[model samples]
Target: MAMGKTPGSSDDEGDSAGFAEINITPLTDVMLVLLIIFMVTSTVITQQGPGGGTKTGLKVNLPKGGSADVTARTTDISVAVLADGRFVLAGNVVAEAELKQAFDKAKEQNPDTVVIVQADEGVSHGTVVQVMELAKQAGLGQLAIGVREGN
Candidate 1:
């Protein structure tokens, strides 16, 4: 008896069989989901800083200066001296002793971190100098005084 040719069979002399092509749709979908997850988490992380301190946006009337303007870095630590002589660090009211600890922690994390003292116009010069000295003792070299632009 003669063997008959089968449809889609490798034995067929004139026919060729090959593996099916791979489908990447599922892989693409998984990658897109992961990307979206990372984007959402990163936004939440930036909203809350390392110590969970958000900018208090404290109102302080900065002293005016005529010197050349310099753009402040976002990484710079802000030490706000209110007109009432209260020290606000990282948006929280901090005592003089706590100020030094905060500066030390910041310097330990980044040795080049700059301390920017934003003292109100009514704040005493001595208070501002006190914060600067504390920052200097914390091993931080860069220090800046926040001032308003224009005269």
Candidate 2:
């Protein structure tokens, strides 16, 4: 009787070694997609400004002034006075009568809250002062005026 080769034994005709190659194309594609997602999110966060609050879309021509340390804080409230005598608080249009109430609510949240007034150059001086006065009545003592830095 002739003896046949064992089933577990490797012969010269067939190599039993499994595939050693690894495909990295799928991994690379997933990593690139994640990188793009992070890039877009970071840009949106930065554009929201330091305070991370919504900014008004009004096109106000800010007055040019000398540079100063006017960094926005988390406890700061932004108010925009439009040339047409409209008041916008934190990106929402509010009536003049309700402006004081808004400031009062902000003061209730934080006693050290600072009110930043951003009035257009075409707005009347009295309008700006009146806004400041309302903030004071709301018990918000800290106030700031927003201005564009002159070259």
Candidate 3:
């Protein structure tokens, strides 16, 4: 045996100690699993809430016989669609062209506020959708369509 040499190795051998390497396979697998879980959960959360509760904010007549009964929060921004095709925002009548501006102002005032869409029974579905779309364009992600309780 020579100096700094293993007993089982021949004299012609060099440095027998190999380089140390870290095995990150397990870490990478765990990270990928966690990423998948987060992606699925995020999609579910963005689609809808648990019970799909809706809040009302105006005198508009809502359709009856809904399973859910929800009340409006005081801080919520109200956008009302009247039967005459006019839009009422926060108790004041606003023109269709100003709808997005109104919603944007409301959102700026309360960033955490949700938009409550109160559409009368006689209002067209397209009008309601337009209001909701304007609210979305104003950066208001949270919204609820109003519905009245049935007898």
Candidate 4:
């Protein structure tokens, strides 16, 4: 089982057997690297929005009704994610491919904009993530997930 030594290679008589040793150090190293990477990413993604390094120029609609009313701050920009994964920027429906350009323009205009992510109940989580990435790329700082008051 030692390196540079093969039991069967010596005796071509075809009746020799050699055991192999499995080293797990490489696997362990890879796993540790992955863990460290995830840990760093976790720390980096602890928050969302403009002050959070993500653009907030969306004025998406919120799901109707809740335990109470959510006070809409005049200073915040609302970005809504529809059930079909469309982005609503500033009370307007922004095309999927056009989102980045729109966000870029918004970012150029206002760097302190606050973003509100209002996802429809039926929308997939992936859709939200895509929009969030776009927001981050736009260099926004304050990001908010608009949640209605719980009953």
Candidate 5:
């Protein structure tokens, strides 16, 4: 009787060759854990800033490692932003687009005027930022945001 070759088998019976794609579930799990860790750590880092006290939404202890910067004197101009995006200075409601001129007038009277920005919790961040830009254009060197001490 003659020996016949196996149709689908390799001639070298003892050797094996194959390539297979592996699933990425394990890698995905590891990335998710790292993401969670970074999220928690970032929250902790922003908590403490200069002045030895913590205010709501403001930095507390000085940021780590980098040289600390001394902030310039804030001008005494109070810009109150209401919840509805109205810009008010000294109790007068000013339109959002007219802030530059108003700030110029304030600066002309007092060069040392510091712009203090006060915003309600319900007010949008964009409204507050607009007021800040106006203060800068008004020729004031100092800009500070007002925040509650606690809560």
Candidate 6:
């Protein structure tokens, strides 16, 4: 009797070969998901505007100037000086002495901590300077004046 080869059967050598084509469906799906995530996050960040999204909820008329934008950092301290002469440190109303103590504590935690002072346009120059001076005295060398970007 003669031996016959069956359909879909390999030769007696028992060699098997796999498809060389690569499947990219999973890769494409991952890349699309990552792209969507990045787009959503970027939109959220831009909507938050500058000041690192640290909303102190104290609305102050920021003086418009041609100063460069300062990127706020988490390690930075934000102090708001209202026109009524009250100081809001990190969203809490604090006296000048308390503000100084906060600055000192911040300096102790991180010598490179930056102090961002946002004073109302009606606030006296002396008041703003006082805040800056306190920050300087606390050994926090980095200081920034918050201002709206305009002419």
Identify the runs in model 1 with alpha carbons over 4 angstroms from their true place: 1-55
For model 5, how does the per-residue alpha-carbon lDDT over 67-139 read when each residue is reduced to its tens digit? Answer: 3232324235666676776766654667866667767876887787667676877777787787887778767
- After superposition, the stretches of candidate 5 with alpha carbons farther than 4 Å from their true spots are 1-75
Q: Taking the tens digit of each residue's C-alpha lDDT, what string does model 4 give over 1-151?
A: 3345566576545544565567899999999999999998765554333332323344334555555343445445566787778777654677866777766766887786666678877778898788778878889766667665554
**What would the per-residue lDDT of candidate 6 be over residues 108-146, giving only the tens digit for each residue?**
888988888888999999999999999999998899888
Candidate 2 residue runs with Cα over 4 Å from true position: 1-21, 46-59
Please give the lDDT score for candidate 4: 0.65
Residue 20 displacement in candidate 4 (angstroms): 99
For model 1, what is the error of residue 114's alpha carbon versus the real structure, in angstroms, after optimal superposition? 0.5
User: Could you estimate the TM-score for every candidate?
Assistant: 0.61, 0.72, 0.55, 0.49, 0.47, 0.63
- Top-TM-score structure, candidate number: 2
| Selected candidate, larger lDDT, 3 vs 5 | 3
What candidate 4 gets wrong by more than 4 Å, as runs, is 1-75
- A best-first ranking of the candidates according to their TM-score comes to 2, 6, 1, 3, 4, 5
Q: How close is candidate 5 to the true structure, as a TM-score?
A: 0.47
lDDT of each: 0.77, 0.79, 0.70, 0.65, 0.60, 0.80
| Superior candidate under TM-score, 1 versus 6 | 6
For candidate 6, what is the lDDT?
0.80
TM-score of 4: 0.49
- Where does candidate 1 have its weakest 10-residue lDDT segment? 47-56
lDDT of 3 by residue, 2-70 (tens): 455544454565544443356999999999999999999976654433221132223677677575544
* Per-prediction backbone clash count: 0, 0, 0, 21, 11, 0
Residue 11 local lDDT, model 1: 51
Error of 1 at 17 (Å): 50
- List model 2 lDDT by residue over 1-151, tens digit each: 1136554566676754444457999999999999999999887665554441435555678899889567777778888889898988765689977888878888888998888898999999999999999999989999889898999
